[model samples]
Target: MRLRPPDRFGSLVTLRLLFCHGAVDFNVGVTTGGGGMTGFSTSDLALLLYQAAQDKNRWPVLVAALQETANPFDDDAIYRNPAARRELLDQLLPHISQALDMADRFESQAVSQNLLDRTLEMLPMGVALLDDELNIIMLNQQADRTLAEHEMLANHDGHFKINNREQHKLLHHYIERSLEDGSSHALMLSPGNPRSVSLLVCPADLVKDRDDNDPPAVTLFLSNPDFQSLIDEQTLTDLYRLSAAEAELTRDLIHGYDLRSIAQRRQVSELTVRTQLKSIFRKTETARQAELVSLVLSGLAPLRGRESVTAKVADDIGESTGLRYCKGAHGQRLCFAEYGDPQGVAVMFCHSVRGSRLEVPGGDSVLRDMHIRLIIPERPGYGDSEALDERTVDDLAEDMRCLADHLELPQFHLLGYSLGGFLALHCAARLGDRISRLGLVSSLAPPGKEAGKPLKGMMRLAVALADKAPGLAETVLDHMARTILKNPRRHLGSSVDRKLLAEPDHQERYLLALRESCRQGSMGFVQDLQAVARTPLPEPSSLALPVYLWHGEQDGQVPADQAIQLDRWLTNSELTLLPDGGHFFIYSRWPQILANFVAE
Candidate 1:
């Protein structure tokens, strides 16, 4: 399965060699023309193929790369034009197939990994493999669901933790014991709480069949009765052809409710409950309640919890709660979700690096009260938006102009949150008259001597990495995004103001936003960080538009001085510094921020 390089691609091989040898920085906008035949550059195809060669999920990586390069616009283009996709496949698939075949010559490692992943995903209980340092090496789909839904456990920077101090120590001890003497241990957690769960840790034997790298030392199994029923009512109705009432009844039964209890909760008679249960049984072809529940749980229903990003959002966001896509200037698909009053004043929001269209700070009610029409666009490779081969703040600002034109927004207030500030800043300088005002919330500033001075922990490492190694920075940021998505409680815990997220409603909204941030992976975020790190910071004097800057004194991600510097630099700008605000200060101060926009 050897692939001969086409004679026209003779020079591309040298480019690939240089890229592989680190002699070239692909992140520095490396482009090699393909004789003007294809929309994609030879270098882009070569790089994607190289990535696919090493990626476990090579087919999807290759296919997605092709789709991205082929049409570049129209997210649905692949499905709409099979011939186009096939043409792409013909050009690149053979090379990737050969690479994969060479890699699998000794063993079908790729197939084995897929099988192992599928097996873990199908398990009803959460499964995680951790090393002695408590760093997670592997996490299954149920593990993410369990961690997201449960309060007893959390993951920070891929390290697993228990909320209870004693339990946390005990879990660590058990992991150490398993690693030291190959022992197995089990314990119950949060005994009286509805979120209570049990954990089992066992030593894992070294696998001779695995590659040279050593695997995690301990395998942890987590499960709870409450975690068992993650499937939504809509999924049940769709799968079993049950009516809405019957679907609700089935869900209640699956959640361990008896007929009498369900009837009382539903404000219906026991007879009605039994009748609905009977109909559910008939639809599901099950005779008894236990059997019916077992049938649903043992089958595909459990996997519905890991549905696509479009299906995961709440139903009540607005008329366009789901993702709506518009074609970018380059025909790229620009995705955004609209919230608040559609007829209200338009305020285009730029989400953080790891955020999506669902990254509303204070939710829809706040926007409605302020009479602000909030439009949160998912940057390329975030949420349902298309991915760009190369991205720049200037390119992104142009895309925003396309979106504004598509939405018929003659003028709108621009707001950037966290990493999104880079885009907002560029838009302010680039879009000129189209932007009424600029608002930055806990946003990033241009890299300077004091760039990483005000940050600590992950944020600091991320900034430093972006400066020294953009590729590695993207990988690290993407991993962090996954961790935050899998366990948003960890994200909340790490924030400065825990009290705001303490309220269950506020907490749920925050968690949902965090979850959607990485819905399509964190490529958008990683790229944004690179663009910001590489792009020249705009001179304060140049951005003559009325600028509003908000920063938290206790901010852990960005320096407060940067905001103050912007305040001094901009001629007509105002600055607000919260004594207790942090990186997420926008969530709490959004009302004040929106008021400023409305006042204008």
Candidate 2:
């Protein structure tokens, strides 16, 4: 599709090009308008685009142009009527979606790379195939079309040649050197032209269907400075179901327009823009505009094999748990489960000895509503994480630092229940800079520090064995894993705390969570009990991180006195004492706990 010269037309021509397949963009073709449009005014841009819209193949290009030029408020004149612009956008979405589907289908076909040659035709950049002798074998549609419009360059006998003598000789030398050395070379092409162009000569594997003895050739991947593949507003609208204003806000945000500029450009009050920005956040499941920008820039707009970004996230990141594994310093695989908003306030949830990644009753909805990203990271030797015999309580903070670095979480909140609380306290103290707030619910004080009462019955005996003899503790845990705890329902009435399991549904949830926790082995269970009795943690008052301590007054396992002592030890701590609460006080206060996550 060759673009006609502006002189040939009665009006100014603004021809934006789009490669519907991948996100390849070139800015030079339509230089006088705006993004893809080469910077033209609203009415002039619309007329020029309407002229190209006559061709059915140019619809996606027009959509791309409409999206790009809508920014900076100048092109708002074209889309002055909000309803018309919205109706046009709604109509344009399905056409581009259909085009992408066709493109994807064409790519997966068993036919040889003749499709690749055809696809290069759709790319906006000037692509060329050359041999060892610098003789052009083929040029994609853009090369032919772009060269035809150029004055300093032309296609002579199917080979690219510069009109200037020195430039032609230099281009020839670069191509020959690239083919001979099997490397890549690049140069900028200007020759006092209106726009400078980036020219790259890179060695490429022979295209399929080539003769067996074909000499190694080079492919030129020219870059057009004006070509910027912005987020497809259609894809964002389809993915998030955002309103026209919301979608417009999202597009402008990705293009580096700040909130104040966006408000001024959109001709709306800052409050309205802020409202739309918030709506975009909720729809995209992101927390801030910074994240919204990153989400779009990361190619979350389904342009490739996937149909939608949300679907792509689910497929790759997993559903519910969103399980992921990364190697620790010792090369042990540490597992972490992610859920809720991807770019919300990150809160790490440390697991108990008898818990893995499963959320407690009513926890999921609360986290989702609170806009908090709960990160459930399995400790050493638990769940899918590797069991390290030498793994101590202090090592947790370092491991989590690495994990947070990988996930790009600079600072976040931390929550730990029961045995997990010990790990949380140590983490907060060690990683004081990274922790914004810390919550330890029904958490244990140091082994013998609880003043109310010691653990009773089988739990007392188990703790004793764990402290005196870890080997025997593992044996007992293994036996319980294979027999008593294996069928949680049968022992639900007696084996565990009945007060915590007052309801049938609670019993069932506990059972499932119990089963998932012990899915790997009993080694972590034994090691945890030993750590509970012997782990050395930093003094609470020495730490500066804000802490929230919640415990039940009537609790038997870890008594209320532990919470009191913890509160007293921490300089900045808030103690919430539940009068009739048990070790499982969190199950009833799930909503309140999540609501309290947000604060000044």
RMSD, every candidate, angstroms: 14.2, 30.9
Q: What local lDDT score does residue 307 receive in model 2, on the 0 to 100 scale?
A: 27
Determine the C-alpha RMSD for candidate 2 after optimal superposition of all C-alphas: 30.9
Best by lDDT: 1
Q: Write the per-residue lDDT of candidate 1 for residues 416-461, one digit (tens) a residue.
A: 9877885788778888889988888887766554332333434544
Off by over 4 Å in 2: 1-321, 448-460, 482-502
Q: Please give the range of 10 consecutive residues that has the lowest summed lDDT in model 1.
A: 1-10
lDDT of 2 by residue, 1-600 (tens): 111112211111111111121111222123233434343334444443444333333333443443444332334333334444444334444443444345335435523465686666545477888776667787876667666766667778877777888877887888788867867778777735546677888766633345558766778766543333435667788888998778778878766789899989978899998888888888889998778777776655623222222333224223464568887656678888886677677988887777776645444555666777888888776767877775666677788887888888899899998878867887788887898898988886664443224444345445545555455345436445544443443332232356567565555555545566766666677667766666765765546777888887877667677788777767888888888777766777866776675565
lDDT of each: 0.68, 0.63
Q: C-alpha displacement of 549 in model 1, angstroms?
A: 1.5
Clashes of each: 1, 10
* Every model's TM-score: 0.55, 0.45
* Best of the candidates, TM-score: 1
